[model samples]
Target: MITRRMLLGTMVAAPAAACAHSLTEPEYPRVGAVERLDPRLDAIIAPDAPIEVLATGYSWAEGPTWVDRGGYLLFSDPPNNVVHRWQPGVGAAPFLKPSGLAGPIPAAVREAGANGLDIDRQGRLVMADSGTRAIARVDLATKQKTLLATRYQGKRFNSPNDLVISRTGAIYFSDPPYGFSAFDESPLRELLFNGVYRLAPDGSVALLDDSHHRPNGIGLSPDERTLYLALSDEKRPQVLAYSLDAYGMPTGAPRLFLDMSEGLAAGRPGLPDGLKVDSAGHVFATGPGGVHICTPEGDLLGIVATGKAVANCALGGPNGRDLFLTSHDMLARVRLSRPA
Candidate 1:
């Protein structure tokens, strides 16, 4: 277990992108200094450790994924409908342009912005395609496009936001009615209540639960025994946790493991949209202020100190010890003793 003080011993605690931390203050920066959730966690992160801001740019940044092979980060610029690639040495550049939408002309552009990204076991670029209203993949090597999933029953999905790929090639994603609803835009009636779903290795799509109000971000614990889903549109939003079966399918009613509205006074409205887990069951959720570190029990253990309403984050760097964060018009980073 890592404690706050121990993390601070080796790290300097400061905001990398301090100016864009949030629209409002989160608890007015307490005078006694930030406290960690418990002493046991001090072994991992020190409370006063510095949070380094790596990059800052973009208009409403959404999904963030680590491209390990490229040794950098690839994330979304939603309103711009594009994806960017950022590396420490070269800085950020255009990674995927017009990432999704297609028009009459092959060069025609239509809102191709990407939402979330992940690499499959086979090394394919699996993406939560918001503009196309589907979960698609692009071969990281050949750059070939393959549609993984688009519809649940007979209706098309509203928009696929975030996804994770298991070792077995099984892909899981969260579909919420956020995008323009290109799939089924007829009367604007949502047939299925925004759900957390799974796409098996066989290419079959299964609805794990339609209960999630608006599943925004989705990730699995290192052990695969627990599944975490972020309800972005939740009133007084929260990150929910569920017990999963051996097959990696959820088996029970999802419950709130953590309520995100506690520390935030003025910040982003949604809970989280992108999340990543460490070797342990601990989860890092992008919240209104920054990347929130939570225990398996859902306790708010510490923060990465992005000083911004971090929209998404991923574990990367030389050994995955560096944390990359995202937000509206900002991209930041922090180093961690633990790997992403």
Candidate 2:
């Protein structure tokens, strides 16, 4: 029952006499600073943007989604099997318990909870329910979950990790073996390969790609002409972009978008996990070192370094300029120049 307010109190308990600051003191505890790579980053991020830590101590926070209707943020802590809601003024609280599995915890899974979340066109919460190995939709009012897709061809998914929804109501998601305690070698794993899939509005599931060893995060470009996939493979941490056909299917092989090998070698804590595209087509992808901001052309602009393994990010706020991060054990946020 640890709430955000409790964590905040513990984090900012310093004596005023010992740490006095000017009127410009930040309201929250700031963990990291913005790493500006290109001069263009100045246009996207303020020169003094601080990575403000909002909450601490989650099992493994992931899948941040901004609920515009309620003006709140929702994110998943997979290992704890909970979804938390963070509001601007009220702070963070548990929004759903048993956020993934309703039954007894299964021995096969290491983390039996939802990993990714997004709001559908109808404003219902859609989730990558790793506990059930399926993609499901959640009704906000009654907290009811309806399974959308559970299997592909005839095999159960290893685990649905992350997802993005197209304007046409198509749900594009990634399935990897992260949920399994033994990973790909787990006896419970049904799929031979990790895959990126598309769940059509007609309830049919289509396999987009199965080449990636660990496809973790998924996103669509603002124009919706390209789809981005993040490979969490430690050896080849990178992002790939695929050209989508008019039918909303990938038309050709994916091309390299951003490589995080150098950052990984430098000992950055995170792998490429979750990402989001801004209204102006800029990409904010979580990778080694923090969240990497890049242009549509894949030029590196900057990094929102959280000093921890960042798992996911979402854009929202009263003005849609706030970038919320779900770091490994805490939640943080930074203000962006552009809207999401």
Candidate 3:
């Protein structure tokens, strides 16, 4: 029952107050200062949600997912190849190191694949692995991993970038050519186009779609009837939406969900990567300058003004009111008006 508005009543800090000028102040006139990086996003959320700095100082954080059980937020710092945990009152902690590989693998090559993560319907931690090109399970008790999927059409996936477990345990993930071996004699391997895939409970891998140039972020609609994904490749950069059938299978033609490159502050350093949704359906997506707020209808509400090309985010803290974020080299948080 914790909502974002309730958490903000206690005051939230902007991600970087040093570079952000609060519009709440009268002297700071709107003077086109509020940039909606994606032109299509201009109508997504709302322009008034005040942003505040939360936490900071990390290195290239990605893959943020919430763990309501532990009352903390978790995200991956890829360059460091580790997962970090954060709670509102107690601060951040080293939740897990050398996050396990999905399939049978050697210890030396295991840690390299840990990347995207999610909480399965069973309340267990699940993740996508670039190091191993597979999706895996993390037993809350022993932290043992059970491989879910890693191959399709007799070929290994390039990398499992991001994933989501449906209410029924169905697994969907994005595959890109970012996890292959570089003649390093590493055990990691990859194949196939940078695609979006689905893993059935029986370990069957389905190529959901391949239209994306390089899909980096993926999420389901609040109603579970649509698939929203981000294409990191500037050639086809966009937040695309796909219609789904009753079984949650994606069908029909995909459409431009949000062409961020045409947005207010389009020319920035980063591309869309990781994203999360709230119970009420608002999407907090990573953008060049910070987090971009979007309405369920794919309209842009506004930006959170993190002052960094935020990599990803998740809802945690007491009641999911805390917005945990990972910028290029920093981890931070803030109170929002919506809970995830």
What is candidate 3's CA lDDT for residue 329? 63
Candidate number of the best TM-score: 2
lDDT of 2 by residue, 1-340 (tens): 3211121110122243123221233388888899999999988998588879888889888999987666678999988899998767557899988889877987878789898999987778999999889999998777889999999999999989999999999999999888887788899988899999999999999999999888989999987999999988877789999999999998989999999999988877788889999888899999888899999999999999877888889988656889999988899999987776
Kindly report which residue pairs in candidate 2 clash with one another.
Answer: none
lDDT per residue (tens digit) for residues 1-340 in model 3: 3211111110113342222222222211111123454555433333443344444565567787776555456778654556776555455666666664433544444236467789876667888876656788877556677787768887777667888777777888887654543312334543535789878887788888876656778888778887888776655557888898998787787888776675424656466777777777777776555566787877776666555566677776564466666766666665554445
Better of 2 and 3 by lDDT: 2
After superposition, which runs of candidate 3 have C-alpha atoms over 4 Å from their true positions? 1-57, 100-113, 181-190, 263-266
TM-scores, one per candidate: 0.81, 0.92, 0.78
What global local distance difference test value does model 2 have? 0.86
For residues 102-128, could you state the per-residue lDDT of candidate 1 as single tens digits? 543122222356688887665568898
By TM-score, how accurate is candidate 3?
0.78
lDDT of 3: 0.64
- Those runs of model 1 whose alpha carbons end farther than 4 Å from true positions after fitting are 1-35, 104-112, 181-192, 234-236, 264-270
* lDDT of all predictions: 0.67, 0.86, 0.64
Of the candidates numbered 1 and 3, which has the greater TM-score value?
1
